[model samples]
Every structure is written in C-alpha cells, then in structure tokens.
Target: MAIPTIRVGLTAATRTMAGTSAVPKYSDKENGIIATDRETGEKLYTVMIFLMEEDRAETLKVTVPANGLPNGLKPGMPVKTVDLVARPWANLFNGQISSGVAYRVSALELDSGE
Candidate 1:
C-alpha cells in the first residue's frame, strides 16, 4: 500500500518560549506554513529557525508533513531550509535594531514511491 501524505502550513511569528514542552508554541500572527504530499498519511515535522538581520534575533517555527518522507526522518534529521526575516526598524537604535521576523520552509522527503 502506498503511504499517505499531507501538506500543512504554520506561522512562525510571535513565538514565546514556554517553561515546559520541548517545542515552543507559535502564534498565527507570524503566518508560517508547511506543505507535503497528499498521498501518504504520516506525521508532521516541525522546524525551529533563528535569524539575525541587524541586531535583534528573530525566532521562527515551521511544520511539514512526513507521510512518505525518505528514510523515516527522525528528530535530528538534517534537512535543507531557507529563511526570510523581517526588515530593520527605523527610529530605533539608529536602524541597528529590527523587528526580527522570519519564515522557513522544510521539504520532507518520503519513502513512498508515489
């Protein structure tokens, strides 16, 4: 039987580190998203990314479905990803500070031959 796959999108903005839970809870204002194949029904993967544009560092979180992911991706699987951070803020720190906004996309490879 062919594995199942699904696509999902999660926002990475407005992240607050909770004292508990290994993963940080992300809000919707960030508008982050993840996508996967629609044939395999597998678990989703979340990726946390940090970027520094000027001075302030921004935290971003993203998720991707791993239904047919290659080699059954684990928690520490190495995946290639890209980042887009928010622009610098004016009238603050002489343009040395920034809002710290960013987004990430994780493409999970599945094993299914679909």
Candidate 2:
C-alpha cells in the first residue's frame, strides 16, 4: 500500500536546529540494525528541530538522507526545512501496536529571513 505524505508548513512556526544530527533509535551497528533507506539503501540521519506553533510547541525529530543535511548546522540557529512532510506509521509486532507520525524533509536551510 502506498502511504500518503502530509505537507507541513513552518510559516507561523519558529524553528531551530535542536541538536547535532544523529542516527535513528533503531540504528545500532553492533546489532546489525543500522537504518537505511528502503528505496536507495542509503543511510539515514535524524535531525532534531525545535518548533513553536500558535497552540503547540514540540521538538520534531525529522529524518533526512545522509547526504541531504547541510553542513555546519548549529544548534539554536534559526532554520527552515524544504519539502517537509509527515507520514503516519503503524505496525503490529509481538501483538503490540507501535504507531506515530514520522516527519521528513528534503533539505534543511539556515533561515536568512522570515
């Protein structure tokens, strides 16, 4: 089944690079559980973005291609994401349900204005 992506806007949301880019929680080299792109087989990295909206504020951990993230991203620096999207995921494992919304972005840029 093809999952639909929901576009996310940062127009009224103030954002910042929360911390250094890191691998996903399931990424563990020792256990051979490294996370890779399902389509390209390329590795993936997660970026923490601090977002403040009108009624809600939370840090979003958005995934991006290993080579997609820009270099020299400083924490607390004003930033914006291009082609931001969210995908709802749910899986049944061990008779348990794991579900959440996953966020992704094509590019992350240091906001020069607005």
Candidate 3:
C-alpha cells in the first residue's frame, strides 16, 4: 500500500504582506514563463509575507493562486492565510540532492482575527 503524505497546517499569530501580491511565479528560470497549478489549471503567483510568532518574525515566499488574492493588498497590510499547508519535497539534480518546503495557500484575506 502506498502511504499518503500528510499535509501539515501552518498558522501564525500575525501575518503581514511584504511585497506585491500579483507577482507571477516562474517555473522555468531560463525561459521566464509563468507557472500554473496542474490540478486546477490556474496561474500561480508568488507572494512575500512576514509571519510573526511571539518575539520573532520571518519572511516567507509563498505560492498562491493568481486570482486567490483579493485586490487592494499592499505591503505592510495585515493579512490572514486561508487553508495553508506545507509540504516537503526532495529530488536529485545533477548528482546533488535539493530539498525545500513548499507552502500552498487557498487565499489571502484581510485579517479579521477570526
């Protein structure tokens, strides 16, 4: 039986926009083409966010849907993550192992503290 990978939910006490929310995500670095979500066939966007926990805050480059972010979002605006999940992936490239955590967000909305 194949073991299904469990997706861990991610949250933060506070999140703020760090950059433009409409930035396109590129899959091919050389070609400079925008990436897309395979399952839903939607264009992908990369958003810069700062997640604050306790006394620390770290910036994260998160992948989100092109249309998932509501308009009027700008840097320093307080936001909340919707249905956030993180998955770890690793692969061998040219005899070297490369690994990273990929975060997916269903949507980003103004923080209502709900």
Q: Candidate 2 — which residues are off by over 4 angstroms? A: 22-28, 54-56
lDDT of 3 by residue, 73-102 (tens): 787777877776776788998999998888
TM-score of every candidate relative to the true structure: 0.29, 0.77, 0.80
In model 1, the runs with Cα more than 4 Å from the true position are 1-42, 67-104, 108-114
Per-model tally of clashing residue pairs: 23, 0, 0
Per-residue lDDT of model 2, residues 1-113, tens digit only: 67889998666545555565555545776887758787888778788888776777788898887767677776776677878899999999999999999998877877766
Give the range of the ten consecutive residues with the poorest summed lDDT in model 1: 14-23
Task: Evaluate model 2: give its lDDT.
Answer: 0.77
User: For candidate 3, what is the lDDT?
Assistant: 0.75
lDDT of each: 0.37, 0.77, 0.75
Q: List the residue pairs that clash in candidate 2.
A: none
True lDDT of residue 37, candidate 2:
80
Who is ahead in lDDT, 1 or 3? 3
RMSD of each: 14.2, 2.6, 3.0
Which tens-of-lDDT digit does each residue in 18-107 have in candidate 1? Answer: 111123223342775333334464345555544334446545454444421335444433333332222222345865754542232334
Cα misplacement distance, residue 58 of candidate 2 (Å): 1.6
